[model samples]
Target: MEQEKDTKSNGDDVSRLEKYKEELIAIHHKSQETFEQQLSYISAGSLALSIGFVKDIVKDIDCAGYRPLLGIGWVLMVITLLLNLVSHLLAVKFYRKSISEIHRNEFVSSKSDTRFDKITWLNWTCVGTLVLGILLIIIFVNHNL
Candidate 1:
């Protein structure tokens, strides 16, 4: 009777452990999916905003002649900004998700480590795009005046 009781307890523990693992996996997958959805939404929004901003820049000018490059500059800037936003949203989302799952998942650390590249690259892209945009606007305005 004593042996039977021990065996039953051990089996219960094994079953519980497996259940916990399965739960953790499900949680991790759900968390990852949420992040991915947000990433897609953000990417789409950024692209739309960039396109609109560029369209505004090149729409019309008071200058005697149309500045061809004004439009192009805005275009480049907008594209860069959108790309940077994409990188940033994805990187940050992935990092946060990984941190949240660190306790249950060993792979979180590896995923977190890879986000640095996205961060740095995104930073540069945003900076370059903004500068280009400002320069282009100035050029267009000066020429129009």
Candidate 2:
């Protein structure tokens, strides 16, 4: 009777392990997609920043009254870039963690992928800052003109 009970428990464990493997594969694909999406955001943000900077410099608008505003705008943009970088790094970190959990046979489907929520907030903050910076730059340039 004890042997029968042991065999049944082993079968259950094997079935559970198989389910975990299937779930882990899906989680891996999702994590890869998330990482790729984050990289895209970083790349796009870089291009926008570069173009905006070039345009601003080409205009060569110099006004003493708006100098402070221009300075603040530049600072905000720099911060935005830094935050984007941090968010990108966070994506990598989450991917590594997910992989590690899977290897340890401790992966839980419910707890696997939501770590990127913080990255979403960070991305939004980056966008907000970039927009504010552009607005300030526009206001300063227009005022000077």
Candidate 3:
């Protein structure tokens, strides 16, 4: 019957839409993971490079005036790294909670999730701190030079 065909077509469309949504979600998650990993790598690498620069390149130079700036930059970098780690853990927790909710037939909305909000805040904070830390380090080095 034409009616039956229309109903079947509608059902197929709904199923296709669900599959497309799932694929998009997977891609989003993958991109987020990649972003976090890169940020972590950059933060850690910057910290190490700054330390090495101070130890080897500026060893004899008395950067006493700008020492505080360098110290603050180091602190910021550490904080960024810590925040990244915390955000990653919170993301895992959020996903686990979401999975449990799905299993219970409860709809989980990311917009209403405090954990997701925290993760988002932490990620942005990490970006801010990392940029500030790098800027301070650059200023310190330039001033010393």
Which candidate should be chosen as best, given TM-score against the real structure?
3
TM-score, per-candidate, Cα-based: 0.47, 0.58, 0.86
Give the deviation of candidate 2 from the true structure as CA RMSD: 7.4
Worst 10 residues of 2 by lDDT: 56-65
- Residue 78, candidate 3: Cα error in Å is 0.3
Per-residue lDDT for 18-73 in model 1, tens only? 99999997996686456445544544444455445445753545433545655666
lDDT of 2 by residue, 1-145 (tens): 9999999999999999999999997997687567546645654564466446546753554433476667777777778778877887897888788889999998876676568778778878877877787677667656664
- Candidate 3 has what TM-score? 0.86
Give per-residue lDDT, candidate 2, residue 61: 43
CA lDDT for candidate 3: 0.86
- Clashing residue pairs, backbone N/CA/C < 3 A, model 3: none
Weakest lDDT window of 10 consecutive positions for candidate 1: 57-66
Q: Which pairs, if any, clash in model 1? A: 63-144
Per-candidate RMSD vs. true structure? 9.9, 7.4, 2.1
**What lDDT score is found at residue 57 in candidate 3?**
74
lDDT winner between 1 and 2, please give it: 2
